[model samples]
Target: MKVLIITYYWPPSGGSGVQRWLKFVKYLQDFGVEPVVYTVENPKYPILDASLEKEIPKNITILKEPIWEPNNILSFFKKENTQQSAGFLNPNPTFFGKILQYIRANYFIPDARKFWIQPSVKYLKKYLSEHKIDAVITSGPPHSLHLIGLELKKALNIKWISDFRDPWTEIDYFEQLPLTKKSIRLHQQLEQEVVEKSDAVLVVGQTMKENFSKFSKNIHVITNGFDNDIDSTSITLDKKFTITHVGLMNADRNPISLWKAISDICNENADFTADYEIQFVGKIASEVRHSLEEYQIKKVLDVGYVSHQEVTKYQQKAQVLLLAVNNVKSAKGVITGKIFEYLQAKRPILAIGPTNGDLAEILKETNAGTIVNFNDVENLKKEILQLYSSFKNGNLESKSNNIEHYHRRNLTEKLAHIIKETVS
Candidate 1:
């Protein structure tokens, strides 16, 4: 079987989104499918996660098409949103940030990826004519890729699968965008259209699958999993109780109160104060900077972004890995890709997020770590002190063995099954 995957986030440009497709393509061969990837030449992605580039397979074919997004022009204007402008140079958004958001939300079709649709359709239409593909799968945040798949399904009568890394209309951060009322309705309508048209719709977590079931029966949950090769090494945990968080982080996901609590207790307790570090190693939100500033925690080490291989080393060295899920209505369905990596690390996790979602459930089942409700200062503080005491008293032990089910090859095999069933 020949499968063509359209994604906006692809390696060289890294993040959680890139890993899904990259890993899928890498493992699809085992299930008797040949994978070909279609991605944008110029992506309006937030940052370049160079670490993730190593994960891309060398043998797989990749087709890159030039994307002329209005964002290039909007970014030139240096825009700012009136409500909450970080007033910093946002990598993607410029001074015309508000204008760009307005144009993108209102003018761009289903999602901002609306810009990629025409070009993608134009390119893929021509590409498919020469290459016979068994199936086409489009994963999104750039739901525009799905729109192109929807159009292709109509034009060529080919089986198209649409994967949703996150919910479309159900995304918690939807309201944060500069979308007009009309555009919001249009976004929902377009999302439904994608749902109605696609042969199958893949969601990342169980809650996402349940949420999308109200709209389309096509939904299936094929979750994110950790790379076995990356986690195969043995790591010796350090004596100091080091809590680590990797990947892109923002204030909303950062537990400020927890940091404050840690500072307060450590100040009072010499044992707790002796050795504890909040190690953050990736793109950090300004809100996190503000919290770290407020608490004056010099131990909040910003280790910038490191390569993917280094992530394994970092996770291995830390006593407790940290998973920060945002607090949004849609957050209930969100299971971060980091959790799977954390599981593979064979270290206890200290999660700062909701206690109800799939993440909390998995953590509880896996005996991976302690989950504190988001912004629950007292509980977070208590957990920190407990961790400090455990480390100081030599009571900490690896508890990640229970989550072996989240291994990458198994997850990719699950995805392969979904694709086979969809095309059949």
Candidate 2:
């Protein structure tokens, strides 16, 4: 079976968005499905990791078309050499920034990539007429890609699947966008159309599935998972009781309570403080840095934005992996792609988020780690001390269960099954 995947994020454009489809495409052939990737020829990626290019499967078709984004025009107003940061949704914007956000929200409709929809539909219509594709899949956050899929389906009557890595209107930063009442209604209208029109709707978590269920009964929860390709048997653990977080730490995800708990523990127990280190492996927001300074927690290391190849090494080495969901209204629904990787790392995880959310359920099921509520500093301190004591006794480890279900190849098989069912 041949499926054409339309996505905005792809290899060499690193971060969470690229991993799901990239890994899916990597293993699809094993399940008797061939993937043809269609992405922008030149993209204004917020973050770049050249190492990810090595993971693209060989002998697969990759089609690219030039995209012109409004960010290019907006860049003139900002400082030179200032790249756009992901997950940094500025809650409070300057006057000029607010104006830009207003224009982006209202004029751009779904997103800055809205311009790509018509062109992509037109281009893919021609390509599909000549090619022998069995079905089509479109992944989005730039939910505009779904618009392309909708048009293609309308034009060609193709079997189409709309994949939502994150919710459209329910995204964490949606409220922060300076949107008018009309724009808000338009976003909802478009979201409803995409959800109801697609042959299948794929979501990353149960919360997303629930959010879209009202629109489509053919919703599937194919959570982002880890590839079991890393050989961590020979890797050595870190000397210190290191708590490492491996992705972007925006202001919303800043673990203030955890920082206070760590500080409290350090103040009460000098020996524990001496053996503790808090390490962050990606971009850190200024607010997070300020919190660390406020806590007087000096044993810190920031290895800014390492390649995905390097992430597994850090995950394997750490005494405890830190997973902090963004403390927003949608905290209960946020399940990051890193959690499954942490499970595969086989290290005890220390997560800070809602205790009853999707992430908490996964942790409980896998026996991966303990989760404390965002405000539960006392519990956080106790958990940290217990882990520290275990570290000292050389008994700290994760007894993750049912993790085989989340392997990349296995997930691809499930995805292939869905595609087969959809096309049949």
Candidate 3:
């Protein structure tokens, strides 16, 4: 099977978005599928990790085109970088930035990357005509990439799969955008069209599958998995009781209650404070910083924007991994890719979100750790104290089971099966 993957995030585009298909592509050939990647030549990615380039399959066909983005121009007016990893929205935008956001939300429709869709479709339409492709997979958001797949399916009647790393209308920040009713309707209509028309719709979680099933019967839940190149046996745990979060902790993911719990514990127990450390490995919203300050918690470490290679080191060494799901209506389906790596790190996980949500289910299945609801500060404190006790006893390790199914190679084999079925 020759599958052409059309994506906005690719090699050197360091972040969660790129890791999913990158790992799938890395091991696709072992399952008898040829992976051809289509991505931008000059992408305005928020983060860069040239180290990821080494993961690309040798001799794989990679198609590239230059993309023109408005982020650089908009950044000057916004007074900050517009292309933040994991859709890091500025909570307090300047007056001029609000105007830009309005234009982006209402005018751009899906995203500013709308410009790339037509050009990509035009190029791929020609490329598909000349190649022997079994199927085409388009990943999003920038959900605009699905528009390209939609157009190609219309033009060439190609077997297309639309992969949603996150939901469309149900995304956590969908309401955050200053969108008018017409714009909202347009987004919904486009999303429906893509879901209904694609041969398959791949989502990262079951809630998304259930939600999108209203539009299509071909929805598949293919959760993200961990794929670290480093040997895990060589890495050692941190000497301090480190509770680490390895990805974007935007305003939505801020666990103010958990911070308060930790703060209270710090004041109560001097020894606990002495041995405790909190670490954030990527971009965090200012709101989170304010929460930490409001709780008067110290010993916070900001290892700003390290490469994936470095991210795993932080994960494996941590005494506890912190998984914060967005405390929003759509958060039930919002499973961040970082959680898989945290699971693979085999450290006890401490989560804050909906207890009955998808993430909680995974944690329960693996017997990895405990999850406290967003408002449960008391439980957060109890969980923390228990973890601290375990650390002191030298028995703080994750007893995860059935996690091998989430390895990159196994996931790719499933994807390969889907491609074969689609082609047949």
Candidate 4:
């Protein structure tokens, strides 16, 4: 079977955005599916990891087209929002920034990438006439890409699949955006059209499946999986009890209560103060920085952002990995992509979110980590102290069970089955 995947993020554009499709494309050929990638030619990515280019399947066909980015042109008006990555808007912007934000919210409609939709449809329309593809998969957040899929389906009556790595209207920031009632209604309408028209709709979590089930009868929950593992032969674990968070973090995910608990730990236990260190491995919002300071947490090793190659090492070596989900209306469905990799890392995961949310369910199924609710500062402190004691005893590690199904190869096999079903 052959599938054409239309996505904005690809190799050389790093971070969690590219990892999903990149890993899928890597192993799709092994599952008897030929994957053709269509992406932007000149992408102005906020983060770049040239290392990811090596992961692309050799001899695979990759289609690229030039894109005119409105974000770049709008940068002069709203430097902060323009520079921000998708789904992560600046928590606080200047007065003028608010104006641009309003413009972005109302004018962009689906997203700033809306401009790419028509051109992509025009480009892919020509390509489809020439090449033989059994199905077309549109991966989004630049949800406007789904509009391109909608157009292709109408134009050619092709089998279409829309993959939502994250939710559309249910995304945490959507309600927080400066969108007017008309804009909100428009967003919802488009989301419904895309979900209803697609032959299959893919989401990353169960909550998302439940939320979107009313729209699409063929919704499938295919959570992100980890393909790579790090070698821990030479790298020694840090002597200090380290808690590390990897990937892009926004204000919504800032763990204020967790920081307070850590602060209390540092204050109450003198030995803990000397032995504790917190590290952030990617772009952290200013809100997170202020919270860290408010707690008087001094020991920090923030390596801003690094490549995927380096991230795996951090995941493998940290004494405990911290996963913080957004505390918003959509928090229940929000599952950070890194959790799968953290499971593969075999380090104890300390997560903060709804105790019964999808993330907690995964941790329970795997027995890889413990989760404390957002306001449970007492339990948060206890969990930290328990981890600290384990670190002292030198036996703190994750013993996950039944995780092989979440491997990239296995996930690709499942995806191939879906593709076959769609085409049939």
Ranking by TM-score: 2, 4, 3, 1
How well is each residue in 155-207 modelled by candidate 1, as lDDT tens digits? Answer: 99899999998778877667666777888888888888888788888988888
- Which lDDT tens digits does candidate 2 get at residues 1-424? 9999999999789898999999999999999999999999999888888888888999899999999899899989977965445368565678887787788778998999999998999899999999999999999988999999999999999999999998889888888777889999999999999999999999989999988889899999999999857787799999999999999999999999999999999889999989999999999888899999999989999998888889889999999999999998998899999999999999999999999999999999999999999999999999999999999999999888999899988998999999999999
Q: What residue pairs clash in candidate 3, if any at all?
A: none
TM-score of each: 0.91, 0.98, 0.97, 0.98
- 1-424 per-residue lDDT for model 4 (tens digits): 8899999999899888898999999999898899999999999888889999999989799999988877787787654544675456776778887887888899997998888988999989999999999999999888989999999999999999999998999998888899999999999999999999999999999999998888878998899999865576877887889999998778889999899999998889999999999989998888889998999999999988888888988988899999999999988888899999998888899999999899999999999999999999999999999999988999887788888888988998999899998899
Which scores higher on TM-score, 1 or 2? 2
Best lDDT among the predictions, by candidate number: 2
* Residue 60 alpha-carbon offset, candidate 4, angstroms: 1.1
lDDT of every predicted structure (CA atoms): 0.78, 0.92, 0.89, 0.90
When superposed on Cα atoms, how far off is each prediction in RMSD? 3.3, 1.1, 1.4, 1.3
Model 2 lDDT, residue 54, Cα = 80
How far in Å is the alpha carbon of 69 misplaced in model 3? Answer: 1.7
Question: What TM-score does candidate 4 get on C-alpha atoms?
Answer: 0.98
Score candidate 3 by lDDT.
Answer: 0.89
Over 4 Å off, model 1 = 49-55, 79-97, 230-234
